[model samples]
Target: MRHQKHIIAVFGGREADQKLLEEAEHFGQLAAEAGWIIICGGKGGIMEAVCRGVDAKGGISVGLLPEAKDIEANEYVGIPLATGLGYARNEVLALACHAACAFGGKYGTLSEIAHALNNQKPVAAVESWKIQGVHECNHAWEAFEWIQTQLK
Candidate 1:
């Protein structure tokens, strides 16, 4: 049995940024424990951290990927949906979520955040490189709690 309520897409850096990865994983775990489906880019860094956290907690996760490239999906990803549309497919992934959380990131994360906001999905930023939507704590736990409260 799966509890799929408002899938929360987490967007952040691909690089091995410690802060971003920690925050992403924390947020992903929190969301999963709270019974929300976790959605992500399905790659590395923030995405990998989040997926790992979700899996560790025995929660569900979805990887809305650009395409199934030579590389494989992250270990934590339960469902990998290859759009085959490249980065542009990010819009579809971001829009699919009822809400989105953005941590430290560059261009790709920024794009997902933009799409989520454009689609009216409540977007939250946790110590992001560029702040947008709701600004909250630097920690993912705090950010997730705030987002949950906002949705309620």
Candidate 2:
């Protein structure tokens, strides 16, 4: 039997700072190198950064957009899924992936984390939230490592 590629959802702020964006980009690159597909919110900031990294490494990126318009997705998104569910799309994002990772974010990111946990998906956080049951890491690489273990 052929093994399926793992899908990892990366959640973060749409208006994240440059440092956070860089970290997210590196996280996406590492995930791609590990042969995992990246899923994200499909907008700007961390989403765009991660998608760009995935594109740079020739990895596929799936974008879950809250809007119905395909133009809402970032340029690097290889696959744009327009849900038109707004914040409710978080449920789809959580359920669609094998695991999830959260960078520094706002309410939207928090919602994604909650949805993932509620769906029984393992989640790793990098300088993000401090909720119980969520693996916390100091860096994106650490978070990816934890996610890799969880996928096993």
Candidate 3:
């Protein structure tokens, strides 16, 4: 029997700063080193950063795109899944992953977090929202660790 690869959803703002982008990239790298695949919004900012880190580590990265156009996905995305659901694609991204991690984000990121939680999926946040059910972490490593625990 073969073990299933864990798919972790990474969520954040498209307009993230350098600091947040670096953190998201580090988080992706850590998760990839642990033999996990990454899923993200598939555009720019946090998504692009995470995908870049995953690609650097030779790990697969899937992007759930909001638009039907495949070109909308960032250059780092290994697989672009165009949902054509606009912002509603967040629900699909959350539902398709084993767990989720959130970085600093705005309304869209918060919605993804909520959707993940609503689906009973475990979520860890780093420099993100302070929701009651979400596990707060100081860094990506901590957030990834919490996600691992939830997956088990």
Candidate 4:
């Protein structure tokens, strides 16, 4: 039985620098082209970048907003959900994704990575944390390749 949610959680820093933001967007475009739905904690920075790419490709994206109790409409996001779970939403993101792709991030991204690993979901990373279990990639293509293989 092939158990696939076909959802890939993208975790990254809200304060990500320009390079990381660009990489995340490119990754999103590639992933969307592969027909995978992108999910991320809703806000700005990396999340918004990914949304832009997804929107460009007419691909679907789900945003889990931590602060909002009601779904806030976003032009880029196909589905905007208000979790009201705050940082706890990371746990939901982990459970909902088949795999994860992480770019440069801070503590929140670290937590999402940890949760995905804990759920036994494979994680492909780019310039993210150097945790032992993370499959680190030099760039988005490498990470996307690894992610595709894992999903398969």
lDDT, each prediction:
0.80, 0.91, 0.92, 0.87
- Model 2 misses residue 87 by how many Å? 0.9
**Global Cα lDDT for candidate 2:** 0.91
List all candidate RMSDs to the true structure: 2.6, 0.9, 1.0, 1.9
Candidate 1 ranges beyond 4 A from true positions:
1-4, 68-71
Give the per-residue lDDT of model 4 (tens digit) for 26-104: 9889878988899998678888888888888888899998876544434577789987788999999999999999988
**Across residues 1-152, which tens digit of lDDT does each residue of candidate 3 receive?**
99899999999989888988999999989988999999999999999999999988988999999998889899999999988899999999899999999999999999999999999999999899999899999988899888888887
Error of 4 at 89 (Å): 0.2
Q: Judged by lDDT, which candidate is best?
A: 3
Residue pair clashes in candidate 4? none
Stretches of model 2 off by over 4 angstroms after superposition: none
How close is every model to the real structure, measured as TM-score? 0.89, 0.96, 0.96, 0.93
Candidate 1 whole-model C-alpha lDDT, 0 to 1: 0.80
Per-residue alpha-carbon lDDT of model 2 for 1-152, expressed as tens digits?
99899999999888888888888999989988899999998999889999998998989999999998878799999899998889998889899999999999989999999999999999998878889989999888999899999999
Model 2: lDDT of residue 34? 90
Collision count of model 1? 0
Model 4 has an lDDT value of: 0.87
Query: For candidate 1, which ten residues in a row score worst on lDDT?
Result: 129-138
Better of 1 and 2 by lDDT: 2
